[model samples]
Target: MRILVVEDNLTLASGIERLLKQSGYAVDCVHDGLSAEAVVSTEAFDVVILDLNLPELDGLSVLRSIRDRKLDSAVLILTAKDAPADRIRGLDLGADDYLTKPFDVGELEARVRALIRRKSGARSPLVSFGALTFDLNARTLTSEQGIVDVPARELSVLELLFSRSGKVVHKHVIIESLSAFDDDLTPNAVEQYVSRLRRKLIPYDVTINTARGIGYYLSKASA
Candidate 1:
């Protein structure tokens, strides 16, 4: 899943980004509300970790903009303000959930997972294609043969592709999603990841097809 963290605190923002990455989620971050608003309207995100206090535009205004656009991404308010009134205002503005500051990493992860599950209408992280099944939480790809261990990088590629099963996903989109602030992942590297994943998934009739000069997308081969 892709997440956008709108936190003004640089140190805290970096920590959240690193934490979510280690948990196998794609993350992008902005340390202000204006950037967050712009990014939210442009990019596709599964969740937005919003902070109430921000520059240019406060988190509440950003949250309202997200709802106004009718964007389906889940919004989780993360702020130092824990007052009952603050929480109610955030919820009333269409925030899917709320998290107070100084929270546990475990609970944060659980809440994020819950939001994802709620959005996907799935009780678990498993997404299926024919005989294949991918567990987003475990980062595992499997079938009736049992567990299928995919290379970590390739798994990241598959994660983006699988989620966009029918749509034509551009190569740049995959690169941006998987890359960290300083991590270097070129289009060629993304192609290599796709190539390897395609080979591994051939047995299951899951094909990653390239749209020459554009990008790659996923499709199930007919028997």
Candidate 2:
């Protein structure tokens, strides 16, 4: 999943970025709310980890702007504020959840998982497309043939594609979904990964097709 971490503290931002990256999420971090708002306005993310205290614009203002524009991505408030009123205010501003500083990383991850699950309308942790089944909780893929171990990046790509099956997903969209917002990974690198995935899906009759100048589309060939 792709997540935006909006924290002004350099240490906390870097730590969150590193942790989320290690957990197989494409993460983008900004030290100020202006940059955070800019990033959110231009790109799509599964979730936003927003801090209330920010430079240029406060987190509440950012959240208000997001709601004003009707952006539907989930927002999880991460801040030093521990008061019930502060938490209630964030919820009222449209945040999906809130976590205070010095929080458990495990619990934060669990809440993130729950938020994503609810957003995707998934009742179970497993995501299926055709004969292939992806265990989101376990980060594994299985099919009638056998269990196929997928790398983190490939698994993320598959998840994005499967989530919007049969639709044409722009190349840039795939790139952003698979790469960290701050990572220098080139757009061509995204093509390379998609090429690799296409080869792997051959046996399953699933195809990832390029639309030449348009983008990529995933489809299952009729048996």
Best-fitting candidate, scored by TM-score: 2
User: In model 1, which runs have C-alpha deviations exceeding 4 angstroms?
Assistant: 117-123, 164-176, 179-190, 210-222
Clashing pairs in 1: none
Q: In model 2, which residue pairs have backbone atoms overlapping below 3 Å?
A: none
Cα-based lDDT at residue 170, candidate 2: 76
Off by over 4 Å in 2: 144-146, 184-188, 209-214
* Candidate 2: C-alpha lDDT: 0.83
Writing each residue's lDDT as its tens digit, candidate 2 over 1-223 gives 8899999999988888888888898888888889988888988888999999999999999999888889988999999999999999999989999999988988888888777777766768787777788776656789997798777787787776765656777777777667665577676877788889988888887778878887887777563
- Residue-level lDDT for 209 in candidate 2: 80
Worst 10-residue lDDT window for candidate 1 reads: 174-183
In angstroms, the error of model 1 at 143 is 3.3
In model 2, which range of ten residues has the least summed lDDT?
A: 158-167
In terms of lDDT, which candidate is strongest? 1
> Total clashes, candidate 2?
0
